[model samples]
Target: MSIKIYGDPGSGSLRRITSAAAVMGVEIERVNIDLFKGESHTPEYLELNPHGLSPVMVDGDFVLYESSAINLYLAEKAGSDLAGTTTRERYEILQWMFWSGEQWRVFATLTFDEVLAKRFMGKPADESIVNLAAAKLRAGASVLDAHLAKHDYIVGDRLTLVDFDIAGPFSQNERTKIPLNEFPNLVAWQQRLLETVPAWADTKREVDVRIDTALEAAGIKL
Candidate 1:
């Protein structure tokens, strides 16, 4: 049986898992969960993921939550090298995934939610919150930029699950008002991935279209 994923199409976490599955040649059945309508808080979704987060994966009797973990699971299931070929490589990819979730996602989410996501929810951006989060995001971007300067991909020369995991948020940089121009290496790395990685490029295109439509419906101009 094909894996089934429950999430809204516009969800960044959802996009991560879908992008990974795409590159790994894993087919998934996407089940929409309208988070804006509080669908995720329902008992059924909560049963699958107590945290009520998007991108819950179910494969037969097995169930999994957390987008990063789902992506890793899909990679292994598909026998894809993205999970890493060697022990050290797998751990290194894991390290980056952990960092992306713990460190990068924190600031990125805050900035995006405040600057753009709030508007979609019929709320105004919190200037104070946006300022604080933007500052932190810039600092985090600096660290990533430095790393990208030494290597093309997050882990090594080749793309890995961690790259898809981390790049999901960056795809929304423009909407979130992230200053990619300040970090040349980071910008170049993102461009390289978009141009070279068909899975990510395709997923990002679809995601952008969905978000843009939502923004338009929300009466948000940009």
Candidate 2:
């Protein structure tokens, strides 16, 4: 049975899962979910993921949501070293995944929604919300930058889901007004990771175009 993934192509949350699937040799069927139209609230989608979140995976009779969990499951299903070669390495990857989800992901989402997303939607960003989101983003970046300074990948010397977990959220840093130059290590890590994955380029290009249109429409030069 082919695995089914419900997601929005314009959003990077699900891109990480699909991109990982490609790198791990996991074949999947992608179902586009139009979040702007409230398609996620429809009964069909709610059955798969009641929270109405993107990147729901259905393999055979098993259904799962939450991008990180789906990524973990896909990694194990592929039986690859993405989870980590050793038990300790696997645990460390899990720790970073959780931190990326709880801290990095949250701030990334908030900043985009409050800042870049509003511009994309042809509205002005809420300065107060942007301030808070930017502060949290900087804090998260500091820790990540320090860690990346010592390591190429998040959990180990090689690529892992930990890298994907952290990379996915900040993939659009330049377009979203994220100041990557301030965190040199983090910027370097993100650059190398994206360049290493061939499948990521096209989707990233598409996202870049979207961000460009948004910024232009909002009269904000980047």
Candidate 3:
């Protein structure tokens, strides 16, 4: 069984998938797609992923998209501890995975596009949009912070798919200049995640370097 992952290094989805593969001790063949050049939107790529997104996974005849879904698939396939063994554990993993995708991704992407992209990448920033995105992100962070206050990991004590799913978007706070002090619990949770999952911290460093390289190549002062 061979696994191929098509994604750009700087993409959040790519970081998540790569981190999952690392944790699962799986070797993945990476096909880098140039986002700025619109390679992902090309006809052939579109045929593989109708959504034209990064981090598409092809495992033998099975093809999948969505970063979280890819991580879950890889974890299950590897029979790693990242995927819970029991039904209850699986459900708990799914719960946090959903929360990460819906809550964290939504706000992080919005704020990144509105504020960070403009400030760091030289994109135009609309004050109104930035303000709105900031408010939404803060609200979402508060939710995660509250939940994290009582739990070390997203799903009870052990690190599972829930923790993997949120790592990418959560790491964005550092680069995107989103303050974590307001969400102390979330900040603490992230630190603990980094400590427990060293691969996550490594992936974060790689992702940061990749993004900086991409921006530098584009002549954007980030």
How many backbone clashes does every candidate have? 0, 0, 0
Writing each residue's lDDT as its tens digit, candidate 1 over 8-117 gives 87777888888888878899998988876778899989999998778799999999998888888888888999999999999999998888888777777787778776
lDDT per residue (tens digit) for residues 63-137 in model 2: 999888998898888898888889899899889888888877887787777766565566887888778778887
Q: Show model 2 residue runs off by greater than 4 Å.
A: 119-123, 209-222
lDDT of 3: 0.78
Q: Candidate 3, clashing residue pairs? A: none
TM-score of each: 0.93, 0.89, 0.89
Q: Alpha carbon lDDT of residue 20, candidate 1?
A: 81
lDDT per residue as tens, model 3, 36-129: 5678899999988988878798888888999888887888778787888888888888887887777767776777777555555456877776
Candidate 2 is scored at a TM of: 0.89
**Residue 130 in candidate 3, Cα distance off native in Å:** 2.3
Which candidate achieves the best TM-score against the true structure? 1
**Reference-based lDDT, each prediction:** 0.83, 0.80, 0.78
Deviation in Å, model 2, residue 32 alpha carbon: 1.1
lDDT of 2 at 86: 91
